[model samples]
Target: MHVFEGLEQRIQFMVLEVAKQVDETLRVLISPDEANIEKVTSRDDYIDNFKSVIENACFSRLHGQSHLDKAGIDFIRAVNIISNNLERISDFSVDIARQVQYLSDQRFLDQFEYRPFFRQILGALDIVVRALFHRDLSLALRICRAEFILDKLYKHNFDKIITRLQTGKEAQNLITTLFIFRYLERMGDSLLNIGEAVIFSVVGEKLKINQYQALRDSLDSLGVDLPLREVDFESIWGTRSGCRIGKVSGDNKGDSTGVIFKEGKHKKIFQEKINIHEWETILPGLTPKVFGFQESRGNASILLEFLTGCTFQEIVFNEDKEFFEDAFFLVQETAAMIWQKTLKAQPVPCSFIAQLSKRIEDVFVTHPEFNTPQVQFCNLMIPSTSELLEQLQQVELEVTAPFTVFIHGDYNSNNILYNQKEQRIHYIDVHRSTHGDYVQDVSVFLVSNFRLPIFDRIVRCKLNQVSLHYLHFARQFAQEYHDTTFEIRLALGLIRSFITSTRFELNEEFAGSMFIRGVYLMELVLAHQGRPWEAFRLPDRILRYRYY
Candidate 1:
């Protein structure tokens, strides 16, 4: 074989070896009767060794050749990608093995049906193997097609198992089922990832979710059930924490078990939590689906399905104007909903203040100087408290002037979820909701905006603030929520709180504090309104949001 061809062969051989190990690991994980967990654990060493050998071999080839042929370079890159995928597979397999060992001592096998679980793993593995070994376009297509099927299957199985356990008669059995469900679903995902890699190699096109769906549909028409649907919440016997436990009704227990469809399928829609169940109801938009809640579980956790939307921080910083518009609108809508439906006058938690104080202490006490040439945390940028407090007190006067609404604690851009397709904005992670001075959310959101550039540029020009970007976004946000004086107060209060909390490290050389930023912004707002700082010239960027 030629150099490039020889490298392809080597990668193909490695893929086959990894695939074999994966297959064994899946079987060992599913086979409750056998104690093969240790056997699978021991096999990971071989996979790791194979990966290291391939890395070295690839490196050697690059070093030995003065100028590699284009085809040879392409082949090497492909081999590297394949090697990385194989290593990930190995890591996942080891995790599965460990999970299986944990489940071994429990009643995992008794509640969860391992047959379908094993099949999902096997199907995922088959797709990856075909992509690597044969380079068959059809096989690559099949692998790409399996991701959604697997996702739906996992959801179905998880819901079904949870429902079965809810009847609560077999607490031990339920615990076992939980572990099995979590592991099987996780392993299935690893296999799906492998399939995605295979498809990427063959088509040189990254499959969007919609593309995968089309492929899945095509395969389904040919009688291949690529992705499957699951059963309802009531179908499985389950128990609530305080509710009395009961046996699965002979009538309800025989609900159709979730299946990996081969082509013929039926659509069964389960009622999402919005249809029933009452908790902290965020008006439906671009939010994660709350699966259910455990009232007596102490901490009120809404079982939220995973979300894929990127944070506003990512969008704004990337300078994607299209995404930024969507993010801006989404935040606006979410704020509106909170004001209209959720915001209520309530007592603030003592714990929140304590935590905030601790955060300030940790940020400033040890690093008492701003001059240190080290980046502290990747996230926060704090300023010295004493320097920023006077301006903040002026803003707080506006906040405490009788309008306090609910605060979305930690109201940074990261907490909002935007759906581009649905054109929706949803509030998420509401576990920290507090009825504090509305300024808490406004301050966090505004100051946090300083962390993003597009907004910061505007603030820097307008306010010459530390987080100039944030001040700009906050000002616009404040204008948008014009219906409530509470919002303006909240915004002002937020700045004040930010000022009080601002503290730099012990060194002056490190960076300017947020207190400085707050002072700049406070002055800008006053200047813009023709109040005290009216003579101050608004910077060009801040003019983007100039009052009409």
Candidate 2:
């Protein structure tokens, strides 16, 4: 048998041994005894020895061979990462034991709520062990998710300690326990890193385990072993915040799966699931089939059917001028069709005004600098973002929809894909699809065309024309259906687009233009706040809304 034959089993055994030590340390953590501390401390030596053995074995194997395949290297990396994490976890257990030795009274440990933290870490360690050996991406995701659970548990317990301190609890006892929790939480983090490395060894996705699990769940229903293309780190947009989008090239030409990873307060993942449900269950083939999703730990991910074609954004910016009108019309027509889509569910009041209100509220809170009177849109005087929202509240919005229809909550051009050859319009990012006002769809359609970040003066003029034309088209459609509030509604939609889009616009000048355009729409709405909905006029067109 080769040395590499039992390598995984050896690594697994080493990890299990450290886990045993962690359990012993945790046992002593609840009760302070000099002998128990010595035992836990001694376990760290064995843990360190195993770590060194694994490290040396990995290096020796690598140095002994001139050309190792990607799988061999990745396996070595995974083993090393797991060893390092297990060693750190053992070290943390010893640290916990040391902190326990500092305790003047063992009663404080009993007073604390640490069972959950211990349970989570141990559970995570077990999951990692299984996932590492079996290469179960799903179990890896659970291990990754467990770290998040433990971190939150740590924070909750930390707050309890601080609150106890503020109330005059003994600092020494509480501080010692706090250090133990901190060490355990750090161990959880190390375990999560290990899970990532393990998944990378198997999948080569280079993302965390939760992300890998999302992909696994997404593909489970597809029933294909389609080769996953390399994800370019540079191509993954918005790495820090909001929705992170990535593409893996598909087997068929022009077909590539799109990935959306979002983190933080907002939960768009659930909404996207509903959207795909509508597409697959209610309106098949109009939108891409969603494979699956995972929403946890304040993060959400969506795996979407690869819709191949130029996005309307790409078409508007890169395609020739002759295709512009067709692109705009097709996208608008698709939005109209989505609006005309019917289902039996009870429809809610139109959320156009409600969405704008929420987005503007978020704008003021996140980008307070946009709340000044210094902003302008083509000589249009604009005040604070909050003031604009107030004016919107004062306006009498017609909540009763002219016709309740399924609308893409975010009907931006970026989300619209057109395949001219197939004469099909494909929609992406449908997290906001809902039964709402068609006017909302039209409104989003208009501003999405206007907010292209290109700096070319000619392109700006052309974009403005497309937006204005689409507005008229929407108005004409609304008039045909006896919905007379298209003008006012579009203004409200522009405000949502201009303000909310700033979250994505990185260019200083371009973001400023979006803000100004949004403010100008606010000014337009306020100018005609009390007027009849039919009497509202469109704002002056943008000539130079571009990035430098």
- Candidate No. with top lDDT: 2
lDDT (0-100) at residue 161 of candidate 2? 91
Clash pairs, candidate 2, are none
Q: Tell me the deviation in Å of residue 3 in model 2.
A: 17
What is the TM-score of each predicted model, taking all chains together?
0.36, 0.52
Model 1, span 288-348: residue lDDT tens: 5544444332212234444445655455544566776666766765665565565454433
Total clashing pairs in model 1:
42
In candidate 2, what are the lDDT values of residues 269-307, reduced to their tens digit?
A: 667677778866555676776665776665555566656
Off by over 4 Å in 1: 4-6, 29-35, 62-72, 104-107, 127-130, 169-176, 205-211, 214-548
Q: In terms of TM-score, how similar is model 2 to the real structure?
A: 0.52
Give the top-scoring candidate (TM-score): 2
- Runs in model 2 lying further than 4 Å from the true structure: 1-274, 280-284, 290-305, 318-325, 338-353, 356-368, 373-383, 396-400, 540-548
Clashes of each: 42, 0
